[model samples]
Target: MRRGASRDKPGARVVQPPVVYVHGLGSASTVYHAHVAADPRLATRRQLFVDLPGHGISDRPSGFRYTLEDHADALAAALDAAGAVGADIAGHSMGGAVAIVLAARRPDLVSRLVLTEANLDPNPVPKAGSSGIASYNEDAFVRGGSFAAVLERVDPLWAATMRLADPLALHRTAVGLVRGTRPTMRHLLMSLPIDRTYLVGDVDNDLPGRAELAASGVRVEVVPNAGHNIMFDNPQAFINAVAGEAPRVTADAYKS
Candidate 1:
């Protein structure tokens, strides 16, 4: 943990084993703070809201590569330092991808997985979001006004956190997401012999390789009245999914 992990401010009584929450790109772990506080079953469990390097209150190291594996390794060290091994892990979008890599690369750190709108595809088109950020050279992004343009173009909700991230780190991480890891996060996720659950918005339920994921024994749940940002759009569903009381909508039902 070169820059150290960001955690919820201490004081709450720790009852059950700690659970880790990782945020997506251009966002901080604190995004889950309110949602966690709202859930009774999860409120008792210790919250390790980690702000991956280059995001939130964490430091931005110029030397860091900001790749998925790099983020996972750093997360592994942070979990070890916090003595939060074997914790249930939940991640959103880019964070979900990182969590998959973490569970695979360092299985000891994760017990179960709850992913929200994770991109299972190896390569995304280089037009917007991560790929858009990756489309430019670092120099053009970091020094040029490209970063500023991105901040201005995104919705205020995202820009609020994206503004905190280091341009260089953000660019590299996006590039890594586009380039993908050696084994690919999707492959690692499918092969993991753990209690895996993936939550996608009902409107966007047509997730890539969804049938394969279900066939691989992964629980694919749909969060109705929600979009990519599940926590924000429907906190109750997210909490239910995390608490293991998620809606029992069958695969056939979801598709129909």
Candidate 2:
């Protein structure tokens, strides 16, 4: 499912640089197809949908570590393999954290960044730990088989991939996401020397730090009438947000 920009079209003018899209945990790159299709600019621009190690069609080697650093390194390697240098990056949820790390560690590989509801702080949230950093419950996945069972109903291919994914890799990656090492997402985002934007669904009430991010002058866009999964809930809004256009009011009671 790896696709790069088409260079064969004669006289084609590319206004924007290539973009690399990274999906969140438990999801594959296919999650972004709708948003890509909805936006004409993105459809024409060179785009790469990256599947993190053990998540999508990528190989799951025995000794590969799935830490945030490892994921960032893998993403960098993937971009290099595709000969994509200085490409814009967009990531959702856990993928956002990975994109932030990539921008911080390998600035040469990323030009601009668009992060949708990225986990800024991996600390525990309220509500019985049902969301935020606590949401990646490896115990529940292992004991209840919820990951496989739920995905089977929603996405059979993802379910099949989950069955083959290395449990240790999944567990370690989840743990690493919560207990991030030094130069955490916070530090990385604040220090990264590139243009970056933070986007979140307007209905996402559980976001860890909205006020602080706003106060810090980080550009934040709230898609109207959308939740955590902005792409699925409101594909047009997601596309508009990424394209730096004003959110289209598809619903009443638009929240700021």
Candidate 3:
């Protein structure tokens, strides 16, 4: 159940660079190809774009629960399937959150960690009756609705990168909006023990006390002129940053 391609050189594959990509809540891995292409270093590697358990081409079973561990487990399974253990990982949005949890849980499996427009703080619990963070809670907004109705009410929650992409991608991404269970989301939100470099977008103003979260010793960079989906808006800048960090993550990996 993955829906992405892998780019690798033919013949002996000893020099393979493995990078796994986890998409945001409402999108798939197609979002990073252009960014990867912009940087030649990222261009040559086995890039895995995985869909969460119940999203995209992956199975969507009834009563399926979506937790951070579940996403991490699914990612670990994918890496095992692809023989990409100890690979560098990058995640966006919800995927970014998942990446952090995975790295924290299994540091041995992760080399470099890159998170774009992701939250590193413990999941902020919204007020019981608060309409803050838009579609994040309200079942009316998170649940059933026409596309027009959805956009009118919840489009504000979208990242800047999503705004620039084709409307069809948005439509395709909406499939993730149907959260399986309240406890699942809650469990996932509570699993963050932050420590990493998380690149964020200023226009992504939905989160509460974001500055405070940034100050928690995590290297938080606000990508200029971007939104939650920064990769789509400023692909080159994002790619360069990832390319730059790749070496830092791999510098200690001596050849066997």
lDDT-sorted candidate list, best first: 1, 2, 3
Per-residue accuracy of model 1 over 62-84 as CA lDDT, tens digit each: 99999888998888888888888
Each model's TM-score?
A: 0.92, 0.77, 0.64
- For model 1, what is the C-alpha lDDT against the true structure? 0.82
Which residue pairs clash within candidate 3?
26-173, 160-228, 161-229
The whole-model C-alpha lDDT of candidate 3 against the native structure comes to 0.53
lDDT over C-alpha atoms for residue 242 of model 2:
62
Residues 1-256, model 3: lDDT tens digits = 3222333222234575476777776455654543464356666665666666544556544343355556676677677667777666778866776776677667666766667865444433342111133333334433444334544544453433333433333332332323322334323333344335556666753544444444443445557678766787767657865665522222122221
TM-score of 2: 0.77
Selected candidate, larger lDDT, 2 vs 3: 2
lDDT of each: 0.82, 0.66, 0.53
Sort by TM-score, top down from the best = 1, 2, 3
Error of 3 at 221 (Å): 2.5
Report lDDT (Cα) of residue 215, candidate 3.
44
lDDT of 2 by residue, 26-118 (tens): 656665443454367566767777878876666666466677788888888888877778987878877899888888889899988888888
